[model samples]
Target: MAVDLENPSNYLTTRVRQAVNWGRKYSLWPLPFGVACCAIEFMSTVSSYNDISRFGAELVRFSPRQSDLMIIAGTISYKQAPILKTIYAQMAEPRWVIAMGACASSGGFYNNYSTLQGADRVIPVDMYVAGCPPTPENLLYALTQIQERVEREGLVPAAVRHAGRVQV
Candidate 1:
């Protein structure tokens, strides 16, 4: 097949799509909202060991206002649940939440009392990373999942939860 470089119709849509895809492929900054123990693992994932920079997520924002992803790490106490909810709400649209650690995902051993049953009770979690305190490798895996989710959904904010039960 001969290439038609001069024709306006030739590969115009393809070129536009490629450019859009390339821009979206890069530039994903995850906001680490680590409250406790799992924070250590979160740090390692971005640090020298796991090296999250390779995936273009090296810039982990501490402020929810500037972040597109919120990583809820460690236990969400009753006292902290409101704060977490507020923070997640503050993040820009097209944001994602990763519930890291058993404590964050299911409240771990603190199920009986003050801790929240799960971070999901407070925010819409996109991914659940299991562990009393998930390892750096697990955190990276969770990050990869978040990236895949972003690519699949595009830039618009999709609410996975509406009024409690999962939105279908």
Candidate 2:
């Protein structure tokens, strides 16, 4: 016997997942970790003109414990790397890291011996915003991308720990 019945339950489940994803995409709280020049642009994104609040991410918390997304917005020097790592450590599970601006992405112009060369070397970056100092609009775009990434991952609640010396 051959059965030709369509499964309506499968379709409903798919639609439900899509709707949930859409909602989460619009509500991202980005914790701006601005250190230097590019930080200026990071500030602009949260202001009225760019109005990052429209996307529901205006609650930029300075405390890592209260934030889930970390936006590294400037040059990260060697001295700052440990601090950045500490903050990343403080964030809860399922956190995301966005490297904003060329400086944070690849050390930009300060390719001297002090800069970290890239924030990724210190913390795991989920998105990278290009430009010596990206505009607020660009930052918003990156935020959208971060949202997309979150959706694609299905917002799975889990911790992503970087490999390091094991405490024995």
Best by TM-score: 1
| Model 1: lDDT of residue 55 | 83
Q: After superposition, how far is residue 100 of candidate 1 from its true place, in Å?
A: 0.6
Tens digits of lDDT, candidate 2, 64-165 = 888888999889999998899888888886778889998899888888999888888867777889988898889889888878877776575434343352
Q: Candidate 2 at 72: error in angstroms?
A: 0.4
Model 2, TM vs. native: 0.82
What is the TM-score of each predicted model, taking all chains together? 0.83, 0.82
lDDT of every predicted structure (CA atoms): 0.79, 0.80
Write the residue-wise lDDT of candidate 1 on 15-115 in tens digits: 65456645665677788888899998888888887898888888889888988878888889999987887887788877777899999998988867798
- Leading candidate by lDDT: 2
lDDT of 1 at 53: 88
Lowest summed lDDT window (length 10), candidate 2: 159-168
